[model samples]
Target chain A: MFSRRLAFFLVSLIALLLAVVAPAAAQESVTLDFYFPEATANNAQGIFEEYAAQFSEAHPNITINVVYQGSYTDNRTIIQTQTAAGEGPDVAVMLSTDLLSFIEAGTVVPVQQFVDSTEGGADYVADFFDAFLLNSVDENGQLWSIPFQRSTPILYYNADLFSEAGIEAAPANRDELVAAATALTAEGRSGLWFPSEGFPIWLFTAFQIAGGEPLVAERFDQVFFNTTATAEGLQYLLDLSKVHQVMPEGALSWGDGPTIFASGQAAMLVHTTGSLTRILSEAPFEVGTAFLPFGPAGEDGTGYGAPTGGGNLYIFANSSPEEQAAAWEWVQFLSSPEIQADWTARTGYIAARESAWATDTLTALVAEKPQYAVARDQLAFAGKEFTAFRSIDIQNVINTTLSSVIAGDVTDIPAALEAAQAQIDSLLAE
Target chain B: MQAALPVTNRSVSPARKPWSQRLLPYLMIAPTFLIVFLFTLKPAVSAVIDSTLKPARLAQDPPAFVGLQNYADLFNPTHHLGARFGGILLNTVLFAFGTVAIGMPLALGFALLINRRLPLRGVWRFGFVYPSLLPLIGAASIWAFIYADQVGLLAAILRAANPNWLGSPGLVLGAVIVVNVWSQTGYYMLLFLAGLQGIPRDLYEAAALDGANYWQQLLRLTLPLLRRTTLFVLTVSFTFAFQAVELLQGLTEGGPGDRSNLILYFIYQNIGERRNWGHINAITIILAVIVLVFTLSSFLFFERGGRESER
Candidate 1:
């Protein structure tokens, strides 16, 4: 009996020893906090979980804790506050607009050096879609952040309304658009609705680019929004309400143009291409996508697709070198063509990397649904987040001005535009 | 302050003074004072100091020393101060006075109605006070759903009448104020009811002997005796109504275009939405001063009236 007990004890001791040493023998695992800017309890978390699972399976060397920090504003504030307190996360996915500020604050470390240190880093050449790649680079010519989820502006319209109105498909020019909108506005529906408060920047950019006029002064240091071109653009939207009387009474206050369009209250809306997937999945009626309409005089103009607006993975300067290396590896894994395709399939974001389209998964997706090709085709015109305007206040000033016009509180387009410019210029000087 | 420490009366015997006896009072009270000092007084003192300085950060990127420039900027009338923030201040005052003005009378009336023999009086009192027990967020959420433009309870009511309540700016503030009144009236009614029950029955009997009518007896006996209660209700209701951000934020977020930007909501937007800490801090100080002056003046006026009446 004594011999039997001794054998059992010996067996148990060996099992315990193996259990304790197995983890210790492996390479040490690093814990990383990944701040997700657009994440909610909704679809964003599941997408991140898939990536995290794949990454952890491949590399037991690292662990990333995904934390949703509310909206862009909330995430930015939390990051700013934490960085000030010297406790920022190892990796943060923040808005492209915050790129300049992050660089200026010295909160993020440039990953260019890491690439150079690697064996085939030079071969990688740090490629990105022309606009996004350039935008990710700081003034000192150092790459600080990388594009992840990118979206371009597209005109979303109700096909049911268009066909019923006998509108010849979707309008491709300014005059065509005005006529189409007028024709579509009958009975219970308005012709077109724009989210003036939520995304005025995109609508304004699209029109300004098509009109062949500068939206702001060079260096973004001065504002010229009151110029004839912009005034005409502002007047174009306002005319729908004041002159055409084809728009809703409260479009100025609307933040969700999707709901408005889906409800069939508005026949047309200009929103991000990212919205395409949601509409296709959720809409009760047929939906259509088209390149934005252009100005009357300005033809042969390349459609302006602004650099996709979403967060990018960034390594904070406060992280240890080892942790930074691990974070970079995680970013690279996420940026891989297969992962990129997976991300696009799951989330409706266009692939940030050019090579992602060549993957078999993306090819299969494109073959299955031809509309995905429109987003890919528009990549050629994607413009970077205008580096000259390094401040978010510029957009705020412009949006407020546009909202005022929409509200009918400011009727004189030129005067209102001038007021917006003055406000922005003053903010810049401060 | 230093000399005030050793003021215990000599009538106390030393033999009765155990260490615990000497220390218990201080020990029990220390925690409350410490918490109050740490959370309230310290922050207040810091805010005052911070307010006097220009809205500046310190260190390698210290805020620019504009000394009093922020305050100067706030009071500048030629600028868009009124359009920017004055509306909020005015709206706050309107909301405060309007809620109390409507609420106190309704609460008192309900209390009086139920004070008499009525069916299921206990159940009625419990039902009236139930809403006050709910947290502001919980209450506001329900009300927000009720006032929802699309499928809300109030919207359904309006749809039965007419389907245009949510889209109109004219009715939007009214909708919010109504919710505020509903959530708060019950709590104040309970207070008034307690005060009414505490009044000596003899006063009413004596008035009855004098052939006073119900209104006359109420005026002579009930109201005069309920002065302190009235004051408490007014001040407390005004504070709660003035700080009604949950309902405002949950229901409207001060939108349909800043039409409902009450002072607290406006402050929250400036800080949370705009991220202009300087403006937020400046607004905070201004609001504190406004609240201080208004309450103090009310106290002084009421106190003076009381003294004059005695004379």
Candidate 2:
């Protein structure tokens, strides 16, 4: 009886071993090194890991190793450094505008390549918002990256401050913004604070979009900084702080803008929609979101526009074919309507695809907190983020132009901008 | 304990060493020499080469020689880059001068105060050096709060009279200087303390016997004795001021729009933000040359002073 029992135990153990080993032998396993940055999203790393686990569970052969890089720039640096050493992550989420940089470096495989190879390619590409896709294109107009944590600059206002000041609604037009800001202005709190420090080009670009005309057009080499609309926008911004004294007189920090509003130091703040969850959760009083206030630029004399800003998923060219295929699947999984809905619910990033909004996850989220839909609605008016060949250099030129004018270091705005335009052109001409 | 002793290759001959043995000194220094070559000399030479080339915008683009175009672009004058570059240099110079002018004297004063026997003299010395011992980031955060807008210690104290210390371009350089001075004074003070100790006690005694008062002895004895140390401190502080990237990064980030921008921070920005390697290398070479010239001149002056004093 003891021999029979021992023999049965050995048979069962063999069966279990076979069960584990059979699948291992039948299919090849792939491991992917995925690099991501810690943008202002809540628990982004945790959420990403959870998704990776879910994907791996569905596809047992593929395993993803998620590495959290520092900032978006740091992510690019890591990829470059690693690529130089013949080692790089299989996938990374870099700035959407950085598509050009990666494309120029030949480090990233265009998602279109995979999209074309996959089923429902046309519909899948079309599902993403046009505003986001604006920055996803390369010099040849190929969709090089897929938008992930897409965002737009929006007005985050304090409802309590609005009530206290007896303002009716969130500002829409330039006059309304000015009037509302003037009303909300107080001893400590400014009427409205726009962050203009440490890369103010984003803020300026948002304003310029509303003011009409992007800094750059369809061509990577072209720039339109010295336009009348740009001057009007600059004058208005200057007048708000310099002449009206409604906003603070110096460069406000993007890092501090949300916190300042949440802490009631600023009545209203102009910051990214990505900051929504943070601002909403942190504010003691009611918080509201709205489209960025328009300027008198469009045919209707009021144009509401903001540039989309965020990261995009790009599969590395250096990755193996199988890894690239797996990375592409991972990208699709993340950007799928269902996953994007869950993503939008977890973090306040605007859902990259319009279809994501219709999903139950986002439907319930939006219904529960209507403020979550503001950026999505405002996406209709959003434009391309500033991206060019050697974009960062051009951006610095524009940023310094804006900052110096604010700092009173440059007295001539038009001349400074014109010189910047010439400089930018010359930089591209080389 | 060896059963039998044997002379190995290490102790083979007194007349001539083996090749490996002969190469001992060079072998020992190989790592150091390689490190210096790889990190310092190679990069410096590459920077010079890079500065002369029109940078490849794309990594795959062929390297093209632009002669001194990269260097000239910095001072092109068409764009405000040249002007901006000039402004950055001026700001750095002012920063260096300000730190040296204010920091050295303050350091000397603290050293003098704690040098003499007083109650809890160790405590005073410790207090003076404590800030220097604290990490730069920590000191930066503390001062950031002090200089923070709307809700800061200075804001509370001045009651709305406090200007935007870190924000206002007019006052930002001064504000950064103050923070640098606060953190650096202690370090210079320690040097001063060493110099003070080196001065013979008999000199002060002799001056005292001659009926010199405390202030007079300080002027006639301590000041003259500390001239070398003082010069060293000034030169060191000035050189240090040029290397003030962390404080600027932590404090103002070379802003309210380039108000507090110094040379090192500008180079940092070029590398990190602009990614214009050619521009970065050019700026680096220029700043290095400036500091090198200043340092060499100061070294000569110090050497001359030492020689004349000896005579």
Candidate 3:
């Protein structure tokens, strides 16, 4: 009886061991953790999970652990803290504007190596917009983060408000924009209201870029805010507040302009093209989209240029080569034309791949809604803002200063800009 | 024969031994020490080390060990860190003081009113204390909607008289102070009432016989005896006011152009919004020191006052 029991126990233990180790042996899967700031509400979440599942099913050798690390700020915090502790996510999705510092800090690996390892490394849309690819590259010319989800600033107007004001079409140029905004402003309505802090930096940076001002040269370590175009951009928003009275009071307090616009309070809002899907769902009135109003010269005049607002995938140096390969494969999979089209359709973000828009899926979607193409159309006009040491905070301070000026708290344009420049310089110095 | 047994043969069964006789006490407390060391002490020690460095983010910039430079920069009036500390600290202190000043008396009043013979006192007490049980974020969100600028409930109500309740600089502090008081008053009042009940009725009777009026008795007898309880309430309330972030964050975000800005909110904005952890850590260390000093001073003052009163 004892012999029989021993044999039975051995058999059961062997079976249990097989049960535990069989899957790992069969698949040889590497567990990859991909971190993105995109929250659960963004359709990007669903697309990522689906892509992960698909990749796993196809390779049968990889498992991607997708984590929604909260907002962009939260993601940065988590990455910074974790990386400091010598542990960070294997894959991180970061904004292009924020990646330069990360690269400088060596927190990210250059995707160029992986791309080179693959076939046709140069084919990965090396030039995003005219100057954007250069802006995205680190000082070493290493592409630290690929632009997976890119967007530009666009104007979202209430079609119902336009109809009520007897306006037929959205303004294409600065004069037309002012006239439209002035006409739209009445007793209970404001002509245009961008979020106080939300897209002001994007709007102003675009204005500067369009006005032919070098915000930050590639080699320069600081922003050039002393230019006439920079001053003009600052004054334009301030005038919207004091001179035109077209912007709302307490705009400095506005966090998200779309919500205000959707609530039928703001007639027109300048926000990211990324907000289109969410706005479409929430807007009570008909929504119309157009490129941001051009500056003084009209359409050919200083036009709207925007910095990219979206996350790019980056592989961490801490990750194993196998894990890196798996991550890169996953990134390429997502960036492919098929997946990019799916992503664009599901989420409001414009695909970073220029070729993705020409796909049948995107073409069909765009045919149904031509407004979705604005971000892509404005790619030529948009360029990233000058990001240097303490750039993020410097930008925020500058934006706040502009916001203050627009809110009529600071009236002198050059003085406020000078103060902002000095503040940024001091921050950079410290 | 049993008495003559070898000494080595004698043994105490582990299960039969009493808990006091075993090393189980240390075993029981070991987990707590492990947790405290791992979670609290380590992070704090690291933050202190981090505070002495030049301000930068990204883990690779080896924190330059500039001893006391960050601290000096923090106290320097021209710097943003120093400027933020100056303004935000004042707001934080005012917020804490205002919350406690208004909340304590109101709580005590409610407690006293409820302690008396009144219908549905239990229900009223429950209703009063209910808000304290709610999460700070949810409560703040509700208040935020009510205080919304353009079409807020309060704004709509006051629109007839210029609509200046929440948005105006003069009224913004009052608005937040009201919310803070509302959230905390009930819990403190409940504590005060408990302290009041714990006092022997004979003391009040003796005071009454000594010709002490109700107000005098309250000041002389009630307050003096409830000093310990008052100190506790003040400490907890002050800490709550200092630490409460969700309410301020959700409600105003330290804005309408820095009117409602507080130190904790400033720290959060610096760290989270700006990703400037060095500056964040620097500010944190300063705030920690300030809070420590204030707490120690308050405790010392209270202890000295109590001792003097006894003398």
Candidate 4:
């Protein structure tokens, strides 16, 4: 009986050892952690998880772990804290505007290095839209991030309200914009709403670009806020509310603007194209989409621009080479034409790659819901968003000044712009 | 037998003792010491060191030692810091004191009422404490909806006025203060209730026998006895009020020309947006000094009160 028990124990122990060694002998695998912010509108997390699962199925030797971090700001905070402690996710989706900061912290590796080493690298790099590439590449021509989910500000108007007010079509220029807004303002509803609370500067950048003045220089050092064109743009925005009385009296929050527009409190709303899907489903009235109206200085129809807004995928420097390679594969898979087209159809975000728009899936989607095509067309005139040496500081200064000016508190537009310019200059000097 | 025991109690100087024997006490404390050192002391020291350096873009340029330059820039009127510092400080002070001034009395009244015999006393206590249990962010969101311009509860209730509670610069801070008071009063009431319960009932009975009215007894006995509790509650409330970030982030975001801006929000903006760690650490150090002074002064006042009571 003792001899039989000893043989049974040996057999069981050998079986346990084989169970552990079989997987290791079969194939080597790497598991990567991909962090992204929770989308405020669409069911982004579920779609992202599906993408990860699909990617894992395609590459059976590699695994992708999706972590839905909080908001963009919260994600940045987590990345900063984790990287400072010498550990962070293998890859993350961060704001394109924060690319400079990420590069500065030495936390992210340049995408060019990975792209150059990967198969079909040149074609992959060329697939992305040139407008979105502006924020991805630095002055030295180093590619730091790949555009994932991108958006541009667009005009959303109530077509029913416009017709009721006898407006023929959406506004094409500043003059028509003001006229349409004036006609739309009636017993209870305001005609226009531009949020001043969050990312006000993004909308203001659109205005500046439309007015024929880019806010910052190419070197990301100097700002042109003190220019006459910029002041005109600021005055135009302020006049919508203070002079034309076509908007709410005081400051309107970004979080509230969508609800107000959907509820028909405002006839027109200037917001990110990411809201297209949400607004379409929620608005009680017939929703019409159009490109932002060109400023007075812009050419009749061609010289208009809006800043690109959205997040990009970045690989961390602290990750192992194997992990980084796996992360690159995951990114490429996620940004492929088929996936990008599907993502665009689900979320209102524009496909980051030009080829994604040409995909049969996306073409069919655009035919079904043509509103998605307007934002893609506007990408032709899209410019670089406000990014500088200290982009956030510069943005805050401009946003604060714009908020005060729009609220009718700062009557002197040029003075306010000058103060903002000085602030940005000092930050750049630092 | 004693000799055969081999002198196990041999006298050895502590300096010559075994390493484990010498280190046992330190070993027992090492875990806590390491935690405090890593978390608290290390960051405090690093903040000081970071404050004295010239601000540099992290990866491109290394920071140089520039003593007091950050502090100087913060005070220079030509800079952004100098332009907004005074107003932010004033707003913080107003927010902290405004909540305390209005909230303490309301809490005291509720505590006094709940102390008396009433129907469903347990239910009344829970109802009084419910607001305190709600998360600040949730409360802020609710208040934001209430303060909305067109469809808000306030707009519906005050049909003629249509006050823009959070949008108007003049009224935004007051609106925030009202939310803070509403959320915090229950907590303070609980503290006051505990203090009220600790007071002996015989004292109130003796005062009644002496023909003292309820008002006189409360003024002379309850108020004097609750001094310690008041001090604690005030300090806690002041600290929390000064660090009001979640509510501001959720509701107003320090907008309408920075009318409702506080120092904590300013620090957060600097860290999250600006990435100017040197400036952030400088501001943090200054805030720490202010908090230290406030806490010390309160403790000193409490000590003096204790001494007087002893006399």
Candidate 5:
């Protein structure tokens, strides 16, 4: 009645704006491939599926395709193979130490971009434990990954054995560890199975950190393998068998430790938190957990050092921006305190987030089984794992050198490390 | 040789075959040719070329043409992979010779023992073949448990000695070889059994009628008569032994220091750990050459044996 033509034109302009904005809101459902290393957690496939289902229900526009890769090594192989062919998984949980390899290969996208863009993103990144986050960032402090299923090596001592041997408590220092092991060694069983064969390098690096210095720091190309740390670490392991006679002389597979401990063949085991659940369930005797015994208190306050191990969530470079966005949302949801609490409780992985400790799920779990809290408390002393450029090759050098000396094939530990350090330096020079 | 065939035939012939017939042979061999070319020849050639080239430190960068640099690394005394090349060669020779040399004779011995009429012969045949019937990996696992450090069946039986079977560098290779022989004897026994049945009975009868004893007949007739089967079995077994990988993978992992590290197992280990494909491919080329030499020599030796038997 006032101005019919003018009103019609205004309505037409509004209709045109609606057409532009509608499609932005209505996104096509993105299906993301999430590669998970199955061996890291118990029933990881089922747990991943449940989490994916929860995310899908919340978003309803993104579908997460959970894929179980065989092991951490297998995941690396698959990722490298697929990414070369340009069809890698949109998201994956690879070894935290695998960051350099993946980054150097240009196959991954830094989660830092998302961290910078999101509201209260700094606070979000700040929530994870410092020890776990050490392996997640680069030299420039560029965040390439997020800590999820984290682990550290801890001492699993047999309480019954302690009582039988008249030991006061779990060993807390090098001298005490030797004494307890000596006391526990008996007619049939050794006191401790310090695993150095199947899984040689990880636990050995813990010894290195406690002995004096870390094998490597943030720089991938840098390594310190010929120091007092390396010598003392290998010497300790060698003496455990050669001098103390508390363990066997030959290389014992780390995989066999649980069975040996459960069958009361080993009075104590130095293994990862990942095996805690299985050892706890399988042992007939009451299994008590404690922090690892520290080595020679060094100038830099190197005592009680354990490696922060297990996998981390990484967003790959090959994904579309839309898929990356969706994967980030999924990653955030997976690493949230609630989910992390449940994950820590269900699996033996240490909760990477400080907030997860306060959650009801984890608090209840720790209250029921105090063994669940040992690794968390030990996190105060835990340091970064032995990671470098070409990690596997360098690790093999360290492993074989240690294995050779421990197997009694070589008696000169210092000379062996010197030769190894030379070889490592040559390799890193490449 | 194959490419020369059509040209030589056409040139040396009095008359050419019809077009369809000329094409028939090629058509028949095309699938095999394509398959061999794609799977075997191509990869082999590619490996040879890749052996001369190395990828950049970071994989994304272009590969460098480092001619013979990888080969140099292979011979480098300081390098772990290279330091063990000599030991790997020795281990391979030991595995191949040890398995075939001992296993074949045991197989023939068992076959002769069973070739005569025995009670429940079928059951005995199945019993002897049972170990080989188990999958290679499965059989290796069984032996692994049997050879475990302590509390194993071997440990339990030999409680007085208390040997570390799979752990000792001095003993691991022999331990692995024992498992290989255990798995192989049954299989070679089956082959010998088939060959034993195929032997003409009249020849043995003729030897027996010559006033010869059982050992005489065995030395003269049985050994000569089974020449072809022996040749086939030995050739196959040596090739099989040279390529042994799964047993090591399951049992010893070529460890306690390269004591059991055969050539093939070393290559397999490198393929997993070594990022440089050039070096890995060089190792592969070396393994392939070893396999080739052993295979060629086995056939040549067996063929000479076949000819000597005729004489």
Candidate 6:
């Protein structure tokens, strides 16, 4: 009996040792916490989860835990708080505009670091669209993030309305646009709708760029809102509503613009490419897509530019080395040409990488759905979104000025622009 | 004998206790005090400290002591915030007073109606209080749809005029105030109902015996007796009005160009958008001081009135 008891104790001890040692002897497994905002569409989350599952299956030793953060704004807050508390996710899809904030907080490592250490680094970096890469890089030419879901502001018109108004085609220049809009404004319908709320600066930037005035300096420390081009551009926007009566009387809401256009209240709508799928599915009339109208600078000129807008994948510096490596793998997987093509097919966001457009799926999709090609074509005229140190405050000042200008509350465009520039300068100085 | 004698003496001199015995009550309260200090007092004190420092842009740069510069900047007309502070403050005051002035009487009327013997009293009470149960953002969204131009329910009903409820700068605050009143009246009504229940039945009977009409009784007896409840309701509603953010965020977003911007929303924007912690904390301190002064003055006034009544 004593001998049997001794054997039993020895066997139990061996089993415990094996339990602790076997996993350590095997390859190291990493689990990464991936955070992304909940997409507006229902299937987006499901698609992302499936992608994550596929990634995990291919890389058996790595696990990707996907968490649905709230909207883009909410994700900003959550990431800030969580990272400050040293509990940020390994990977997150953060706003491209928030790159500076994350960098200033010392919470994110540049994507260049990870890419350089990996295979096919140069080719991978070169694959992204130049417009997107412009926003992703800093002053020193360091790539801070990888573009994921990107978009550009494009013109969505009612072709049937244009035909009724005796317009031959979508406007290619400012003069043509105004003429078309004037003709379209009859009976109960408005000529055009430009969203004046929720990132008004994005659409406004297109106008400013078209007028041959970049709103801010490359370093973001200086703004030229009081310039002739800026004032002229802003005045033109105001004339569309207050003077020409081609648009809504007061501040038109960004959220309501799509709905209004879908209901045929507006002949033309200016919005992001992200809304293409929704508009196509919802619009009662045949939806037409066009590049935003060029100003004096013309199509090939520096004046005609639309800001590239959307979120990008960022790896947190707080993550462990293993976790960071695993996250980079997942990021590369998600950003591959095939996956990007699939993503573009599922959602209307522009494919971030040029190679993604070359994929058979995307080529076929653009053939079937020609509207998808407009945003891609517009990329040639795309510029960086307004981003700088304290960008939100600067953007708010410009947005407020734009709002007042559009509302006819601030009639003097020069004065409004001067005030906004002063404010932005002060913000940047601080 | 010795033990019995000591016990009797201990009972006679219970005040002369051991250290543990003396500290028992304090020890029992230590946990709660610690929690309060950590959650409430710590943040409040830190915010006060933060208000005195310059906002740090980079992690490498430690926050520098800026003295009263942030506060001064708030009033400096050359600065963007400095120019807007006056209007924002005025809006906040108007919002508070408007909500109270409109909300209190409506709530009192609701309380009086429900307190009396009536038909479907339960259903009516539930209906009246239902808005309070809905989340602020949810209610604001619903109101947004209702207030939407052209296609909204308001436009549908009032076919003659298409009023931009939230878009019009002049009408936006009043529209928001109406929504606030709708949400809070039910809560204040419940409070007034409790206050009314506490009032003696004989007071109304005595007023009736004196040939007082409903208005006279309400103005004289009910109003005087419900002063404490009204004070409480006013203070709470004032704080709620001052801290209004969800409605502004959901419906108007402080637009048609900062016409409806409130102090709390301003502070929130500073934090979330601008990351100007020092400036935000300064504004927070200003708001706190204003709320404190208002509350304390009201208390003092009430206390003086009570003393006069005693006299």
Q: Reference contacts recovered by each candidate, as fractions?
A: 0.01, 0.35, 0.12, 0.42, 0.33, 0.35
Model 3 lDDT tens row, A308-366: 56667788888877788888888887778888787778777887776887899999999
Kindly give the stretch of ten consecutive residues in candidate 4 chain A with the minimal lDDT sum: A294-303
lDDT of 4 at B33: 100
| Candidate 2 local lDDT, residue A348 | 86
Of candidate 4 chain B, the 10-residue stretch with the lowest lDDT total is: B2-11
Tens digits of lDDT, candidate 2, B132-152: 888776788889889877666
- Name model 6 segments beyond 4 Å from true: A1-27, A38-43, A297-304, B1-15, B273-275
Q: Tens-digit lDDT track for model 6 on A1-430? A: 9999999999999999999998876537888888888434536678888998899889999888888887776687788778878897999998788887788888899989889988889999998999898878776789999999888989999998877767887888877788889999875578988877545678878866766577767875677667876677777877897778888666777777778889887889998888888888889888999988847635443234677888899999899888888889999998999998998888789999999999999999999999999999899888788888776667667777777776666777777777777787777776
Predicted candidate 3 versus true structure: per-residue lDDT over B136-239, tens digit per residue: 77788788777765456765677535343443455667788888888788789889988989999999999999999989988999888888788888888888
Relative to the true interface, what fraction of contacts does candidate 6 keep? 0.35
Query: A254-339 in candidate 2: lDDT tens per residue?
Result: 66677778878888889888888888888999998888875653555555788899899999988888889999989999899988
TM-score of chain A of each: 0.86, 0.91, 0.87, 0.91, 0.91, 0.91
Model 4 misplaced regions, further than 4 Å: A1-27, A297-303, B1-31, B60-62, B273-275
In order, what DockQ does each candidate have?
Answer: 0.19, 0.35, 0.27, 0.45, 0.31, 0.48
Error of model 5, residue A252, in angstroms? 1.1
Candidate 4, residues A1-430, lDDT tens digits: the string is 9999999999999999999998776546988888998534778789988998899889998888888887787788788778878898999998898887777778999989989988889999898888998999776878999999899989999999988888987888888888889998875678888877655788878777776678878877688878876777777777787789898777786777788899888899998888888899899888898988846634454335689988999999989888888888998898898898898888889999889989998899889888899998998778899887777677777777777776666788877887778877887776
Q: Considering lDDT, which of the candidate structures 1 and 6 is the better prediction for this target?
A: 6
lDDT per residue for candidate 5 within B207-304, as digits (tens), equals 77888999998887788778778877887888888888889877876777667778877665555343567888888888788778876887888788
Q: Where is model 5 chain B poorest over a 10-residue stretch in terms of lDDT?
A: B267-276
Instruction: List the candidates' TM-scores in order.
Output: 0.81, 0.88, 0.85, 0.91, 0.89, 0.93
After superposition on all C-alphas, the RMSD of every candidate to the true structure, in Å, is 6.9, 6.0, 5.6, 4.5, 6.3, 3.5
Candidate 2, which segments miss by more than 4 Å at Cα? A1-33, A39-43, A46-66, A74-88, A297-302, B1-25, B79-83, B272-275
**What does the lDDT read for residue A81 in candidate 6?**
74
Docking class of 3: acceptable
Error at B98, model 5, angstroms: 2.7
| Highest TM-score scorer | 6
| CA deviation > 4 Å runs, candidate 3 | A1-27, A39-44, A126-135, A252-256, A298-302, A407-415, A426-430, B1-46, B55-62, B77-80, B155-175, B205-214, B272-279
Q: Which candidate is the best by lDDT?
A: 4
